[model samples]
Structure formats: structure tokens, C-alpha cells
Target: MSLYFFARSLVYVIFKPLYRIKITGLEHFPKEGAVLLCSNHIDNFDPPVVGITSPRKVHFMAKAEAFKLPILGKLLPDLGAFPVRRGMSDREALRVGLKILKEGNVLGLFPEGTRSRNGELGQGLSGAGFFALRSDALIVPCAIIGPYKAFRSLKVVYGKPVNIDELRARKASADETTELIMKEIQNLLEKNR
Candidate 1:
């Protein structure tokens, strides 16, 4: 936990001036309770940017490959991130994420599952929706706008909680819920950009 905060603060101090990072809609972030903070992934820095800006400690699902790195591998879990294998069904990763939400902690997800190659919003994968349905966590859609260049302004915008209570009450599928979550994220990107 201390390492997480220390890394977070370090990112803020280093990236704030270099990127001129600006975040809005932070008020939409809930102060407590189980929350799924879903966002559009754009670059390698997106996770840290969201983590630093969020009021809560975000446990992110990092790529399994990253865990093989000499230093980052050892540090990711300490920073509350677990590994998820891409291009395959990684049930263990899903269980870990759901447990985080069930414990009333924030779990960060990139609905796109990977960074967008075009800097445009891509379709959301079902991870965020799956967690939301299983844990009833609030889905707060966030948009990250950046090419991530030095001295260039970068922005993170948070949208209001997506209203999925009706869908959940009706026992909707995860894919359908994901569509709604992605729609909200796209709206944020369009509005802010």
C-alpha cells in the first residue's frame, strides 16, 4: 500500500509538469463502496494516469506478460495489480478482479482490453460489465484523451455512473452491459474532445 501511494505521488510529480495532465469529472468518482472504474485505454501510461487521479486506490488487471519483467513484475502486485493473460480465457484473473469488487474496493478496467491504436474509442470488452453484474459495483466511465507527448496537455474525463440497474435486474448478459459502458465512454470522449 505504501509503495502504491509512493509510486502514485511520484507519477503525479513527474508527469504533471511534463504532460500538463488535467483531469475533470473527478466529482463523479464515488468516495466509497464497490466501484468499477472503466476507461478507454490509449497508451502504456493510461493505467498510472487513472490510478494517480482516482480518489480511491485502484487495483488494475495488468497483462500477464508484464509480470515477467525483472522489476515491474515484482512491483505490480504490490501496487495492487494482478496479471491477466490476453487472447485466452484466464479464469483466475476474473476471480481476482471480482473478489476485489466484492470486498468493496475499486477495480480499474480498460473496456477495450488493450490500448487503442487509432486514439479513438474502441468497443469495450466484457470484463468491466462482468464484474459490475457479479458485484453490483457502480460503473463510472472514464475517457483518456492524449497522444502522451511531453509538454502536451493530456486529459482524463470521468462520466456519470452508467444506469445498469434495470439491465441487472432483468438479468442482462455481460456483452449487452459492456455495450452500454462503452457507449458512455464514447460519449465522454466526444464531449471532451
Candidate 2:
């Protein structure tokens, strides 16, 4: 197996027992074609948790700052994480994300852009919508609950894909699409709460 798959397997083996991870809605995931997995950012562990729980391989956009570390910088890319500069428009990152989708791969993102320090869902950014629109990828809203604690049970819920075509036909802007995505995530979180 590739390093990425190996690492993901290791994460699943370790965290599944430690956190008692429970995943739902795997049936909602597309069997093939491009997909955009959007979820709330609770902490650094959010990415790995989502990645491991997902039915498909997920390529995540991590903050460029995280790539500055010597060892981690070299390893993250192998683990399906690409650098994205926060607080500014990073066209290169956007292009990379779009490319991943166009190549028929799953691209994972946190619509909130950054981790929620208080563990509450925050306002989502427009980047997720932008990528969805640009790549014509299905947006799968995901909710991850109780991942902060290593010994506590953690849950991940994957909602049905958002109707992007209908939303676009309604003249929904990127920000509006992002809001819709966040709403779906919130609903999923509430259902599992």
C-alpha cells in the first residue's frame, strides 16, 4: 500500500478504539466521480478523523503554515494534504483543489476555513463553494462530533450531496452556497447530538 493509505489505516486502527469512532451515512457518498467533502473544523484532529472515516480517499487543504515545519511539511503531502495560505486568496491552492476534483478525486475541506477554538460551528468561507462550482463536483456535507478528547466517543455523519445545480440556477453566489453547505452540516451535527 502507498504511504497515504498506510497512514490512514494506522489512524483508523488506533483512533477507532481510542475514540470509539462511529461513522454514519456512508451510503450517501458517490460511488464514483468527483466529490467535495465539506465539514466543520473543530481541531487539528478533524482532518485525520474525517479522512479515515470517509469511504473514499480524501485530499485535504491544510493551512500553509502547517507546511512550514521541517518534517511535517515533507510528510503532509504524502498524506493527501496540500498547502493553502489562510486569510488571503491563494490561486495556486484553488487550482490544485480544482485539479484534484477534475481528475475525479475526492477533495476534503472545512468550510469554516479554520478550527473552531470553542468547538462550535462557525461561519463558513466561500472557498468550498467556489471549488464546487468550478469543478462541478458534488458537495457532501459532513459532521464530526466529539473528536477533541482521545478517550471520548467520536461520531462522523455524512449527509447527502447538496444540489449545486439547482442552487446555481437560483443565482446563488459562492457565499450563499457556502451558507447552504454550513446549514447541511449543522443539521447533521444536530441529528447526531
Candidate 3:
């Protein structure tokens, strides 16, 4: 945990200034315990953008390809990121996510599954919905706006917690829950615009 703080702090110190990032709703982050941070995908920098701006160190999911480079493959794990194969079931990725929640750490996820090359908000996959339902972790719906714009002040608006119990009680189907979560993320992003 100390190492996670060290690495994240070091990067935050360097990047926050370099990027001139601006963020809001950081007060919404729980001061202690685990949280699932679900955010929109915009650029390749989205993960680090949220990681650095976040009040807590975020253990974000990174695509397997980022770790294909030998040195990074070894280093990313230490930085609290694990890889997920793009097209596979990725049980390992899911396990890590659940374990992180179980261990009481912030698990950041881009609900869109991948970066949006066109800078448009994309549909969120079921990964976030499933993880939230399984772990009962507090899901913080987040929006990252303007990070894709170079030299612009990036805004991140975090919405109130998503209640999984309501979903279960409502007996929402898999697709329904995913679409609901995506819509919440989309609405937050739209508000930031």
C-alpha cells in the first residue's frame, strides 16, 4: 500500500502540473474504504488522467497490450494496474477487480471498455455492472470531459453512488443494468459539457 501511494504520488506531482488538470466533485470520493470508480473513456490518457486527479490512488484496469512491452508488463502490476485481454472472458481481470474491492481499494474502470477514438461517449460494457453487483462495492459514476482536448482544462464530474440493491430489487436484466449505468455516466458527462 505504501508503494502504491509512493508511485501514484510521484506521478501525480509530475503530471498534475504538466497537464494543468482541473477536477471537481473529488469531495464525493469516500475518505476511507473501497470504491468502484466508473468513468467515461475519451483518450489513451484517460486512465492516468483519472488516477492522478483522484483523491485516492486508483487501481485501474489496463488493456493487455499496454503490458505487452516487456518492461511495462513487469512495472504495471507494481503500479496497481493489471491487464485484461480485449476479446476474452478475462476471468483473471475480473478476479483482480473483485479482490481489489475485497481488499478495500479503489478500483477504477472505464465503462466503455476502450478509448473512444472519435471522442464521443460510447456504450458501457457489462464489466462494471457485474463487478458492482458481485462485490456490493460503492459505484461512483464519473465523467471525464475535455481531457482529449490538448491544453484544455479537463473536467471530471463524479455522480452520486449507484445502488445495486435497487437493480436487484427491480430485477433488472444484464443489458438493462449496463444501459442504466452507461446512461448515468453519459448524463454526468453531458452536464459537464
Candidate 4:
């Protein structure tokens, strides 16, 4: 099996029992084709939780520092994650993300750019919007609810795809797309909580 699936299988076994994760709106995910799975960043567990819960493999733009790790660094790429230099423009990372979507693959993004210190949603960054406008891929909003504390009842709610095609037709700016996505995500959070 591919490392992504293998890791997902392992994480599912552990995370499910430890967290009591309750997933909803997975039916919103398309079985195939390129799509963006955008979610809120909470703790270090965010990426793995999003990837493992996704029905399809998720390609993530992980921090460059993570790739420096002795073992995890090597395993990350195999797990469908590429490193991105945070706090600056990383063109290579952008290229990789666009490539994944252009090839009809899933690319997961945390639109807030980084984890929220207070566990509330942060402002959306331009990355997710850039991808939505540049590529002809669906953008699905996801919310990871509840504390990351062990044995807590955590939830993963996948929202419907934001209509990028409609936005594109109107010549939407990347910022505008970002705003729309963030709003959808905020709505999801409010509804679930």
C-alpha cells in the first residue's frame, strides 16, 4: 500500500479510539478528481487528522522544519506531504500544490496560514484562494472541532465546495476567494459548535 494509506490506516486505529472522533459531511467529498480540502489549523495533530479522515489521500504543504527531522522528514514525502517554507513566499511549494490539483489529486490546505493560538479561526491567507483561482479544482471547507486533548469528542465536518467557477466567471480576486472560503469555514464552525 502507498505510505499515505498505510499511515492513514495506522492513525485511524489510534486517533479514533483515543479521541472519540465524530466525522460528519464526508458525503460532501468527491470520490475522485482534483479538489482542495481546506481546514482550520488547531494543533500539531491537525494535518494528520485531516489526512486520515479524508476519503482520498491529501497532499499537504508541511513546514520546512519538519522535513529536517531524522526519520519523519523522510516519511513525510512518502506520506504525500511536501515541505513549504513558512512566513514567506515559497514558489516551489506553490508549484507542487498546483501540480497536485492539476493532476486531479487532493491537496489539503489550512487557509489560516498557521495554527490558531486560541483555537479560534484566523484570517484566511491567500494560498488557498490562489489555488482556487489558478486551478480548476473544487474547494471544500473542513472544520476540526473540539479540543485536541486525549479522549475528547472531536469532530471533523466537511463543508460543501465553494463555487470557484462562479467566482472566476466574475473575475474574482484571490483575496475575494479567500474571504468566501473563510466565511464558509466560519459558518461550519458556528453550526457545529
Tens digits of lDDT, candidate 4, 1-193 = 8887888999999999899999999999988899988999988899989987888889999899999999999999999999999999999999999999999999999999888999899999999889999998989999999797789899999998888778899888988899999999999999998
The whole-model lDDT of each prediction reads 0.91, 0.90, 0.81, 0.92
Q: Which digits, one per residue and each the tens of the lDDT, describe model 3 over residues 85-110?
A: 88778999999899999988899988
TM-score of 2: 0.96
Expressed as tens digits, the lDDT of each residue in 1-193 for candidate 2 is 9889999999989989998998999999998899999998887788889989998899999889889999999999999999999899999999999999999999999999888988889999999878877777889999998855768888899999988887777767888888888999999988898
Name the regions of candidate 1 deviating beyond 4 angstroms: none
Model 2 misplaced regions, further than 4 Å: none
Give candidate 4 misplaced runs (Cα > 4 Å). Answer: none
| Angstrom error at residue 190, model 4 | 0.3
For residue 100, what is the lDDT in candidate 2? 96
Candidates arranged by TM-score, highest first: 1, 4, 2, 3
Per-candidate clash tally: 0, 0, 0, 0
Task: Return model 4's CA RMSD, one decimal.
Answer: 0.9
- How does candidate 3 fare on TM-score? 0.90
